[model samples]
Target: MSEPLSVSERDGHCSLVLTRPARGNSLSADLVEAMHEALDSAERSGVRLLSIEGDGRNFCTGFDLAGLEATADGELLARFVRIEELLARIWAAPFTTLAVAQGRTFGAGADLFAACSVRLALPDASFSFPGAAFGLVLGTRRLARRIGEDAALSVVTSGAVIDAERAARLGLATGIVQPDELDAVKQRARRDALRLDTHTIAALRQAAGDNPIELDRDLAALVRSAARPGLVQRIIAYRAKAQDKNRTDRAAAPSTFQEGAVR
Candidate 1:
């Protein structure tokens, strides 16, 4: 059975919610493909604004490391490129893109939020990137541009949970809203976009051009470098350890775990 992504609309805003609640809204190939399809429908529906959020405890925990354990070498390399390609679409979408993040948003999930023009977050939401632990290279160029190279390295190196306030201070989030006010916040996001002159928005989007493509190229190269035969075994081992750690952490105490499976 296919996992359902909840779709809702209010005040010119169309929201796409990741429905997998048991696995922390982790990304799998299926979820990635579903996200693309959702964006396609959003484009067709003339949604003035589009927002993506998680249905459970995490906005996204990261890629499914368990799934990646058996992923083919060819596909491992392809994943980074594909993720970046989708991000480009988000960056280039005609309407305003917003990411209303809750819980932890890591790896591709972090990049997913980065792809959005504006990100609103709850005080409890945290952000991190642990992909390096798995040799999963991220779009570092964008990361550096967003938060400066030195800070970006600190983020990747620390891989610690940074709360929403820090994320907002670092440019990763445009606003920090109370968890209870999410609906109102999302509506306000759309209204802000709606108030903007269309020509200005179009001009800015055009000015941005294909800048993300360069980052995609950079990300692809990083993936290709990491996916070379000799490197993967260590990465796989690291992920194994990390997966165990994630399980341990989650099991030790209840920490807003959600998304058993996307499908």
Candidate 2:
């Protein structure tokens, strides 16, 4: 199997590419660990900017659901805790963090995008936070902070897929750009990231209300949610419902032949 993540560093910038196209770059345990490792490396190297993108059609489809049948509730809770930790790290990072998302960025994947300082979504991108469907309270505060509390509440409760335009309107996405424009965006981000010295950057982050207490509360919420009884069962039921809806939608969709016949 190929490595789930690719990390590259240049100047004071570190880039993390999610390489698990087969898995829709989902946050598997290995992938999450790789990300933490990359973050550690970037911090040690004094990286001023960190950018995250995924290879293939989709950015990330959220948590890896494969082998969930065999995964115990305790194990699932542990995985969620680690994911929350990763998000908290990104949310509180002194350096700038950028996420360029395309295709489906769902659940915790959306949370990851929200954690970034610069969230750039491609025209084809869509986002949904369905962790609430499975009774997971991950990243609620960060998301509310990014957008507004009312908007965040609506999005989280509705579990509706927000297109790139809608995401930008909601302030869930900082900007929307085509794939070709990404390099220029990155250039701008890097420039902005380096505008202040490292020390001043850290100071600005603190001054801008990067609250450790709130982060701790977010983590606590996640732990409380994930530690609930029958977590695996709840997730299983949620996935089943989603799969049923997808099948129903597909069945109701008009096929090419049917459309031609109608015409």
Models 1 onward score TM values of: 0.83, 0.95
Candidate models: Cα lDDT each: 0.74, 0.88
- Superposed model 1: Cα runs more than 4 Å off: 2-4, 9-11, 196-202, 208-219, 230-232, 243-263
State candidate 2's TM-score. 0.95
What's the CA RMSD of model 2 in angstroms?
4.3
> Number of backbone collisions per candidate, in order?
10, 0
How far is 176's C-alpha from truth in model 2 (Å)?
0.6
> Residue 106's C-alpha lDDT in candidate 1?
77
